[model samples]
Target: MTETGDLSTAGAQNGHSCCAPATSRAEAVDSHVSHPGADPAVNSESEPEFSFDFVTAGGTFDMGDPFGDGHPADGEGPRHRVNLTEFEIATTSVTNDDFARFVADTGFVTTAERLGTSAVFAMLLETNPGAEAHILGQAPGVPWWVEVSGANWAAPEGPGSTIDNRRDHPVVHISWDDAQAYCAWSGTRLPSEAEWELAARGGLKGRRYPWGNRLLTDGEWNCNIWQGEFPRTNTLDDGFIGTAPARHFAPNGLGLFNTVGNVWEWCADWFTRDYYQHSPQSDPQGPDIGDKRIMRGGSFLCHDSYCNRYRVAARSSNTPDSSASNIGFRAVRKAH
Candidate 1:
């Protein structure tokens, strides 16, 4: 993942791979479309009201890579124990309607909307080829991501797209600063990387996923993730291709929904690949200074063929001002 001064780049940057069965890819192309909008069966019901449904968590748990299968360059290894103070985290990510309310009350403008542009997936831009002419550029290495004018939180897929029926979906194209602004207005803050890991684990120990060792439970999908080819086709086997509702599936043991998938959630920490080497054992925040902010929980675009960072211990980062179609965040508060 290339890090530059540009603000229109896709915030999510990681390196990995995982592929579905070869047979699944061929069938996926025909059955799946470029976008995953509101599925009536998945989101016709309204989202749970944003009541700061916070889950209080505290104590020590193993943090970082446990399997040693993660990329060495990204620095996911030498798993260690991290102790944390009690804190309350929102049970779900901030939804579009939740952000709209914040904007209505504070008149705050997101970086994307202010810049009048943001990075959109190539698939979505396919429907409107003319948008390519308005392109600011492309994300380095990931050319499928095009930076287009007028692509913001309101018009996530660029022009002619709307969140009219996606009020329950997590708001995307939100930069780290935008998320921080919302947290400030709500009297909360984003969770530290350690705190986020603790809450995501849901009291489980050394589990690859939030629910446990298994990716699926009793033939039931636990999160919204890409089910077919990476970037090329999403089979939508989990019932979603893009962002899903904040409460699309059952919550973890701690009652946190979509903690490991749906969208990459921003965390409160300056990212450093080697920070874990000297991190504090007690309530460890991240590095004191860095070029990028940390982002966790892989998005619906994640696939095994490439970018399998959806695991509980995996992570990625982006410049604080960068925003994209598959990035969002949640808020937290220290318990008194």
Candidate 2:
């Protein structure tokens, strides 16, 4: 099955591309909610509204595909140096608990909720066969993606599943537009693609995985990604078949956690394959206008066999309005 491309473009050969050619550019920016589980009161007046810790990073780093074998469709090559200004980013992707609080306070409706549907992994549906009735459609070329009704952040697997104990896990089924709403309410914003790569590198230079070149070191898995196979079977060798806690793995040099896997974190940049060819050298902010938005890192669905986009330099994209079970986000703030 060939999944249709969104608004981003890359040079990878695999069908598992968020980095594929996009449709057409759109004018408006994207919106953020719709997680399950209740949240603690977030009192911005008295208590700190945003509780996640932030790591400050600033330096010049090569921000594109540092290696030759990476998905050229991802446009990861043409590795260029980018001088980034200091910026603070969340230690992890926004948690379900974090998003819950935003939902409780604002009563905001996520695009998934508004659309009354979101994409669910077919594997998940197989686990809960009852939900098969709710299947809306399948993403072309990616048959595993079942667009199921009621599969918002609240009910991740259509109608039967719940995020009950997964509150600390990164909230999924979030569109770029939904993430933006959460950021606005929390007094934060999504990271630019460059800022995201810089932070993901964790002070390292030209390394493949965030922890280094080795995907597994000392018989230990570094991040949450597909284990045995892609889409067919997940050995759960990483202790998780789906999303794990935001802080499940060890942090990188900058003290950021799970920047490479678990979920595809949305970025503020618009999607474009050639943007890197002429992007500003200092603090580049993506294209002036485009159809899709950028997504970085990768998700639990990512596997080296198919989607190796979990690498720091790899990128993918979707329309601002698109949301999926593996698509979540982290936020960023400029240092004062």
Candidate 3:
């Protein structure tokens, strides 16, 4: 039930990936396709308007899995204490509507849009003959992930899919670089790993989830994670098959919505498994350099049978240019 190896390595070893497909930009490129350059826009001088609700959080908190149930290869154990200054974090992940506004204002093109393809859970695609045409190929080892051409945030499932009715849903197919672009344009930044954990913990000292140690409270699902067998069957016990609304689930004690499940939220940290071994006690800003970036808050695809990263202390990472249908991000800023 518990995941043992890192997602990137485990996927290759067992043919089952955790959370989402973790392909790098170099791995995404094909000899037949031409990739475009990233958007050149920078942060705007004017204050950008955001409709998101922000929750203020600050204090000393236990930062890792206190129960010692986390994946050792992921560096989720050896629970550490961290102190954070006052900061504001978005209550919900960035919605399609929110990302739309950012694109409208900055004309920023996400990495997926530029590359002309992105990783999408194959089950999300329509069961039609033409659906196969949009699929470029399947991710190595993770056959459930199909690299679909034109599978950007707007058309999450490929050419025919649209975000028209899912505006309230968290925007997916977002890479770390794409998230950074949105942060720059919004005059906000991605939450550091420490800040993110504090907000996710809500006011609790150390618990398995934002709500408590149990996955369910009174037989009721607390968040939007997979309820049935993963990669093959989802029982829809949480009222969602793919991504849920950005504000679908109950807020944590800190008023953060879907902080543990819904979609994987990117953090402003370069990922390193051993960082916790020598991390700073105050405001540890991940490692200085790394090929991958941190992603917290396991996605709707998380299932106890395979990926139990929905737990509050669970951690994972992906390449900065990796974009997937289950990946999204929230913004944060210094609180006055």
Candidate 4:
């Protein structure tokens, strides 16, 4: 039930919670099981070939706390219990270079490419528009988030823009369909909701921050997020204004990098407001069909004053077909 946003531009400024019951999710998975058909887990057969870092997480854990402290309205209430089996997730969000190879081979056109442009937030001031650059914006990031024409993975800034210099940064302005396409080609799949949450938590039981509560230990910055005023001044405390490299920050207790900040990672689950009310206790997937798809890992823009969802447990969603400049994805798969 959290609002939609990018943690990078909006730092401390972004985006949801959803848990469904066991019976419902179980029924949905079973009814919709279709064929168990192609072992979605068997990437050994794909030509694109994907290799996962494969972090191993196990044991019982508290899924979500609706009535816990500072809980949001839509995330759920009365908290819940869930047990996750063994699983593996990518160490970082899919990078530009990583995605480029997929497109170069498949000629995959991203949603932003197909739609012309995605939502881009205007994050800079209008002063000294003539300083330097090759775009028509006054500040840094698009502050207004207008659907400018000709914006996509190739043209992140807009019309005349290009990803030539940003091949190292994570690919943004992508939709759920785009993410799925990449995963399909890469021989990997999106992490399930339970798998995503467990990975974000990094095996920590109740600590807020990934490294065990205490956002800062002895004045040292932990995650990569905004430190100064949002949407205007960033203070560059994290040495980054927008999306930092996927490996910018330290890894969680599980040794997984960028669990909280940098970019909101897309997961394999459709969104439902009341799903968490009765979410399953063990490896719950999600509702059958809903409007929005699930996204996790609050980005670099998370802040308490506005969007403090950078925490490992926070979540949000958007239309499956929707794409934005702030949103991106990583891939996950079962271990052999």
Candidate lDDT scores, in order, read 0.74, 0.77, 0.79, 0.61
The residue-level lDDT of candidate 3 at 260 comes to: 88
Candidate 2 lDDT for residue 218: 100
**Prediction 4 TM-score vs. true:** 0.79
Candidate 2 residue lDDT tens string, 154-189: 888888888888888999989888887887777678
Which digits, one per residue and each the tens of the lDDT, describe model 4 over residues 1-336? 112222222211223311100000101121232121112533223365332255676557776643243336336344577786666677778888888888878788876666444555445212213212433232124234444455567766666556777776778877777887787666677777767777777777766767877778788777777788765677877787667776767887777777777777777777766787877777777776665667776766667765666666666776565565567887776666
Worst 10 residues of 1 by lDDT: 19-28
Deviation in Å, model 4, residue 201 alpha carbon? 1.3
TM-score, structure 2 vs. true: 0.88
Q: Which candidate, 2 or 3, would have the higher TM-score against the true structure?
A: 3
lDDT of 4: 0.61
User: By TM-score, is 2 or 4 better?
Assistant: 2
Candidate 4 has its poorest 10 consecutive residues by lDDT at: 18-27
**lDDT for residue 239 in candidate 4, whole number 0-100:** 81
The best candidate in terms of TM-score: 3
Write candidate 1's Cα lDDT for 261-297 as tens digits: 8888888787788988999899887876676667888
Error at 291, model 2, angstroms: 0.6
Best by lDDT: 3
